[model samples]
Target: MTRILQLTDLHVFSTPGATLKGIPTRECLEDVVGYIQANEHPFDHVVITGDHTHDEQRASYEAVRSILTPWHECLWQVPGNHDDRLLLRQVFPCRSEDGPGGTVNFVFPAGHWLCIGLDTHWPGEVAGVVEDQQLNWLQEILQQASQEDVALFMHHPPVSVGSVWMDAIGLNNRERLEEIIRADPRIRLVCCGHVHHEFQFRLHQADIVATPSTGIQFSPAGTSPQFADESPGYRVIELNEHAFTTRVHRLPVIKYHPAPDA
Candidate 1:
């Protein structure tokens, strides 16, 4: 079996002590990283969907690079609504360079699966869109994939996740995206970030999934925007012949403690 790890919505900041929703984003990421570092099972690749930085600052991305560089050999990423795509490209040059007009779209190999990362990031907007250029590119790759199982990773869910607020900010061109997915039998899974909550469902022949954020999680069942009282989390996926399995792992909430008048 081929193992892959999915980490999303890190929201790292340049300031080491910076917090989001009352929790230090950096520390939360560190906790998740620490757990992965201690795991016995090795991963073939690490796919981070998006929102790597909350402030979208150079320093914030730098901090992200520092934390992830150790596993750089297997790291693959794409931009989220919160990310600066140009800066992202500069910092993480490992993405597919042959995409249409510098769009962050590419197909790579992960075990027996053909992994695809799509850039749904719409500049200066919280919502996402898979542009026409990206759709053309994806179609080209799908044609080449043949019968190989393809795993798609992006920052926005292509389908609604039962939350009205999240659905509003979801992929704007989902109909087009879904059309492509329906046309391609090789596309087996669609995984994303941005929801800050774990979600999974089936879309025709594909399994759609979302991982919880490593920064702050949002309430899963809310019709409006609200933060969830939960800890940071990530996902582990095992790809086997003709099938796949996954599980979401969350770090236990760490209560803050003050140093006594030191």
Candidate 2:
């Protein structure tokens, strides 16, 4: 079995002492990283689903680089609404058969899995979109990998997570995305971040898995923005030849945060 470690929504700020939604975001992220380092799981790859920086500052990105430096060669990153695409590309450069652009989309091999990273971020917008260029590029990869199963990683969830506000800011062109996904029988899993809460939905023979934020988790269910009193978490996925299994690993002690002032 091949194991992949996924950590998302770090929201690391320009300063190490920053906080997000009342949780010490930097410290929380550190805890998650420490856990992975101490654990016995040997990950084939470390996939970060975006929101690497809360402020999108150079310093913030630098902080992120420092945190993941240990696994630099095995790291894969996608940009979130809050991230700077250029900065992300600078910090985590990977070989892509697809030609250059501000958009970062690429495909690579991870053990027996064909891993694909899609960039859905739109500058200055909370929502995301899979543009025509990216769509076309992905279709080509799908055709080429028709004989093998692929796992997609993106910053935004293509499906709604039952949060009215978050859904409003979800991938704007998911219908097109869904069409592409439906066309490819090789797609087995779609892992995403952005909602900062865990969710799963199966579509087009693929499992859409959303991981919780490593810093602040959003309310499990809500229309408006609300922070949840939950521990930071990550996902551990084990992929075998014919099947794959995954589970969310949250901190043992739940961290409490008072509801933001209305």
Candidate 3:
């Protein structure tokens, strides 16, 4: 089994008091790092789905880079709705921008499983897009790897997850994405981030998995203001040649403020 850990939507902020909806973004993110460092299960590979920084600020990038430094040995990340591709590239130079099939579309051959990462980030919008260039590149690779079962990762869920607030910002062209994915029984699992909670749904014949953000978790499967009282979390995955499995974990966080002055 190929052991993997996925953390997404971290939203790391440089400002001491910065937050996403009072989520204590930075403190909570460190807590996630703490959890992984203390855990017994060492990840063979780490996939950070997106939203690595908040406001596209240099400090946010620095904070995220520092927090995830432990996994630099084998880290793979994609851009999200909240990320700037150029900024991300500047931060993680090891990642290539070989257009569609270059850095964004990558493979892990050592694990005996074909894990593919896609970039679905679109600029200046919460909704995502997989443009023709990316789709074509993906198809070309998928066709070439006909014999391999794939574990796909991206920044956006190609299917709607029930969080209405988030659904409004999900993949805008998922049907197009579906058309490309549905026919491939070779796809074992699909993983993404952006919902700020861990969720599972079936898309076509594959598992559409979403890992929680390192910042704050909206309530699990809630509507309206979007989240409830939860710390922060992530997903751990174990993949075989033909199948993959995973579990999500939320770690305790350092509260930055006292109880709301209700």
Candidate 4:
């Protein structure tokens, strides 16, 4: 079985003072990294689904690179709404000179599985778009993929998760994307993030799962205030041939006094 980890919406910031839970967002991400390092699991590959930085700040993006480089020994990433493409390119080790926009999507073989990472970021917007190029590439990849061994990772979940605000920011071209996946029997699972709460669904006959943020979380059932008191977390996905499993772990932290709604 090939295990892949997904960490998302980190929102690493430079001057994270009183705005972010009285703690630096970087610290929260460090906690997640520590948990992954301490909790022994030889993940075949790591996927940081997006929002690696907050406010699109250069320093915040650099902080993300600092936190993620050690893990880059086995990792691939896609961008998010809060990301700046130019800065992210500078941060990631695999600096691509592919095209003018620097698309970071590709297919890779990992032992017993075939995985594809798709870049879903749309500049200055919360919603995502796959565009024609990504879709064409995806179809070609899946067409050539071994049956029952393909998986996909993206920054935005394709299905709506009942969060009105979040739904408004999901994949904008989901129908077209769904058409591609639905036609391909080789696809085993679809993994994503951006919505800061854990969400799951069956779309295009594939399992779609989104991990909560490593830095913070949005109340699973809410509409305002941005984040909730939920623990920071990440997903460990076990991939075996045709089967895939995800286990979510919450980080350990001491909050100030009583947690709201505790």
Q: Say which prediction, candidate 1 or candidate 3, comes out ahead on TM-score.
A: 1
Clashes of each: 0, 0, 4, 0
- After the best TM-score superposition of candidate 4, give how far the Cα of residue 93 lies from its true spot, in angstroms: 3.5
User: TM per model?
Assistant: 0.93, 0.93, 0.90, 0.89
What would the per-residue lDDT of candidate 1 be over residues 215-255, giving only the tens digit for each residue? 77787665777876777889998888778898998876544
The C-alpha stretches of model 4 lying farther than 4 A from their native spots are 16-23, 95-101, 253-262
Shift of residue 212 alpha carbon in model 4, Å: 0.6
How big is the positional error of residue 116 in model 3, measured in Å on the Cα after superposition? Answer: 1.2
Off by over 4 Å in 1: 96-98, 254-262
Root-mean-square deviation (CA) per prediction: 3.5, 1.9, 2.6, 2.9
Q: After superposition, how far is residue 165 of candidate 3 from its true place, in Å?
A: 2.4
lDDT of 2 by residue, 54-162 (tens): 9999888888888887788878777889998777766666632233356776676765678898988888998998888788788877777734678999999989887
On residues 164-218, what C-alpha lDDT tens digit does candidate 4 reach at each position? Answer: 7788777888788888878876776888988887888887568888888876677
Error of 1 at 223 (Å): 3.7
What is the overall TM-score of model 3 with all chains considered together? 0.90
lDDT of each: 0.84, 0.82, 0.78, 0.76
